[model samples]
Target chain A: MSQESQPEKTQTANFEERLQNSADQIETTLRSLLTDAPRGTEQLRPPKLLAAMQHGVLNGGKRIRPFLIVEVARMLGYDQAGVLRAASALECVHCYSLIHDDLPAMDDDDLRRGKPTVHVAFDEATAILAGDSLLTLAFDILADEATHQKAEVRAALVLGLAQNAGIGGMAGGQSLDIEAEGRDRTEAEIRQMQAMKTGALLRYACEAGAILAEASAKEQAAVTRFGTIIGLAFQLADDLLDVTATSAQLGKTAGKDLQSHKATLVSLNGVDATRETLNSLILEAEETLAPFANKADVLIATARFIANRQH
Target chain B: MSQESQPEKTQTANFEERLQNSADQIETTLRSLLTDAPRGTEQLRPPKLLAAMQHGVLNGGKRIRPFLIVEVARMLGYDQAGVLRAASALECVHCYSLIHDDLPAMDDDDLRRGKPTVHVAFDEATAILAGDSLLTLAFDILADEATHQKAEVRAALVLGLAQNAGIGGMAGGQSLDIEAEGRDRTEAEIRQMQAMKTGALLRYACEAGAILAEASAKEQAAVTRFGTIIGLAFQLADDLLDVTATSAQLGKTAGKDLQSHKATLVSLNGVDATRETLNSLILEAEETLAPFANKADVLIATARFIANRQH
Candidate 1:
């Protein structure tokens, strides 16, 4: 029994190490991107705004979105500097959303990732501008010659990101979620909100990998399906953690969603049903990547990690 | 004397008509873009969010930035539908900045262009999201094949827009301006702040025209210089108006800059000197376009009109 469990333990350790390594690489890349003005521009980085952007983004987190991009691209046989650069761009969008989400007019959180939020660390105006800058920087990174040799790939990435992150995607989802507060939301409405607010970026993370890899339509569709399933699983796991975890564990204000009467799948369905749904999502995500066989092991592990993560 | 002034009057009327026609076209394009989801996307435009975006963007303004793109591109002999589309994208970035700058945490203005600001009309959260969505949509429009058939041009627009709108440009400039409030500023600091905050996008507006027309580097440089000089003129006129014009004429609050102790060239150099400076700027702008001869008559007129306008 001890020998049998040893191999599982080794796999878990290996997965965690890979996740940590990716997060560290992303952190380094993001730090450089935020610190330097892009080459050949006379634009001077305003120190205050730059500091606020650094604070909002450089704070430690799991870097799950970037990890997905890197791992999926690797699985698709396209491991290049551009892949990490594209990953960093997606992470910028994610960080910018978090900064805006924590504003006084939004979630009103003071702490994120165990530190004062950007608004608290700097000021609300600075925070807003920082978020704006980061969002703009994401496109700047994607459109650069460094992101891809082919301008077509770069343009496609820009369009995809703007579509997912703009009016009908993340921002739209945020509007729906804010409006949903203090009102009983139908399950579909809640699901749609969650999909937009969180799932869109997650799905884009995977789609970007396919785009960077120049994957065939069939392979791209498979990876995108995997992304969609994991996106749902990620949100379900988050809902569960919000109900079950503490602020200390989550590094944020937990249970505030309940206090705000925010609707979630966990609130609509019982804990048991939600857990069951998460488990099924994990299976579906695994099945979606089955054609890749062992090449998709990292992504399969990533899905399980997202579904079972404590924070 | 009446006969001598007749052609000048006619030219003025022609310029005004051209400006108005461009503004009307921009209004139509913006309304359509905001109303419909982009083709081939599963994304849904949330109704409340969409309404806020339309309100923020469709509020009447001069549409000066779009006009610059169209006029400059036309002057360079590349009038096309893509020019107007790129113009609309620049307008989106401009409108988004206005929305954010008016938020309670920023400039805290209640009125814009004689209408309630987005934050005042919709809630602050919605306003923030609307601004974000519009900003994101700008890149989306630029990246589309409709904006430019050449992927290189599309990518260049995206990169230019991002650089001009990001930390070192408009958003960074906003941070500097906000930080400078209630404090004395040196002439150079104020100039740098204004350049970043307002000058960057205006410069991009002209450069985008050169880019769209595929002008020579020298011609692009000439247009960019013209843009820079006119950008200074635009701001100087704005500062002059803030001191001289009534809210009824300006369509927004006036004298608020003085009330907030905001630093400006008009505040530093006094009205007479600032007026002198504005005249010199107009001359420099006209000289910058001298190589284009009569082809630049409209733009030369635009510089004069910008400096001499009452509001």
Candidate 2:
């Protein structure tokens, strides 16, 4: 038992290292992307708006979505500059959502990642513009020729990102979740909302890697399915953490779901069942990537990390 | 004088009819695009968010941006379904900006187009999501195959729209304007702000048309210049109307610039000089389209209408 535990510990440490490296790389890429220098047809980047955008995005999170994108593309034998740019673009969308979500009218959280949120750090108006700019910047990055040699690829990435982040995906999910607050939502309704809110972006992260790698239709389907399963796992783990962890552990307010009467899976199914479902989701994600075999080691580890993450 | 005035009245009537027709077409296109049906990987469209989006976008405006896109494309000898789609996409961006700008933390306006603003109509959270969803939907529409057959065209449209609407363009302009409020701003500063805030999207509206028509670089430049001039004229006219028109005439609170201590050309140069500048801008716009000859008649009329508009 001791010997078996040693290898597992080593594997976990290795995966954490990989995750840290990916996070560092994404941070650098985002820094360059958010620089003061205007690109293409942009007239000039407003200094205050730029600063607010940097604040909202440069906070050190796990960058799990970017890690998934990088590792999935690497597993598919596509490691290129475009992959990093695409990952950064997705991170921009995620960061923008956080900024808007933290506004006074939304979650109204003053702290994010253990620091003042965008609206608190800057004025609410600046926060809104920063979020707007980051979202626009995402599409700009995806559509740029530097992101991909093929225009079709760039267009495809833009379309996919927009679809995932738009009304029917993340935003739609946010609407559903907002409406579900202070009400007892059915389990299925909660799942649907979760799938759209957090799950949609995570799914896009994996699918975008396939699109960038020019993976075959079958391989794309497999990776997409893998993404969908892990997305569920990620949300379930989040809901569980919200219920079981403290604000200090989460780096933001926790247990607010109960305070706000927000309907979450854990609220509906209890923590133990949610945990069980999360484990099953990780297993399914692993099975979905089985066809990729040894090449998918990092992606498989990522799924486990998502399912078991404390924050 | 009477005979000359009769021809002038006939021309004005014809131009107004054309403008109304374009507005009607754009309205239909927007209605179809904003339907409840989900498209392209969207799991579902939340009803509340959809309603807020429709409310924000379907408000009766002149649809000036869409009209410019349609008219410019027509001038370039290209009119198709793609033109209308692209026009609608630009309108979405326009409407989204208005929604966000009117937020309580921003302009805090209750009335838009003689109706309650999105935030007032629904809720602040819904307004933010609706604005976000509309922005995202714009990129989605531009990237779709129906917007343009060639992926290159689609990609260009996406890139252009993102640049014009993102950090260095409309959003950036908003930041500048916000910062300049309650402060003394130079004429140049005001122009730069207005150019970014209002000019960028208007420029894109015309540039997109040239792109769709695959017009020569020279023609594209000319049309783009026309758009720039008219964009300035649009803002100047708006400022003029703000000072001169009553609230009922404008369909919104008039003299808002003065009330908010916002800087504008009308404030700096006085109404008479600002009117002179507006006329010069309209003349410059007409001259820019001179190379297009008879094909540019509608566009020239549109420019004149923009400069002379009361609301």
Which is the leading candidate under DockQ?
Answer: 2
Off-target runs (Cα >4 Å) in candidate 1 are: A1-4, A36-39, B1-5
Q: Give the per-residue lDDT digits (tens) of candidate 1, residues B227-253.
A: 899889989999999999999999888
Model 2 compared with the native: what TM-score? 0.98
Tens digit of lDDT per residue, candidate 2, span B195-247? 99999999999999989999998999898899888888989999999999999
Interface RMSD values for the candidates, listed in order?
A: 1.3, 0.5
DockQ of 2: 0.90
TM-score, chain B only, every model? 0.97, 0.97
| Clashing residue pairs in candidate 1 (N, C-alpha, C atoms within 3 angstroms) | none
lDDT value, candidate 1, whole model: 0.91
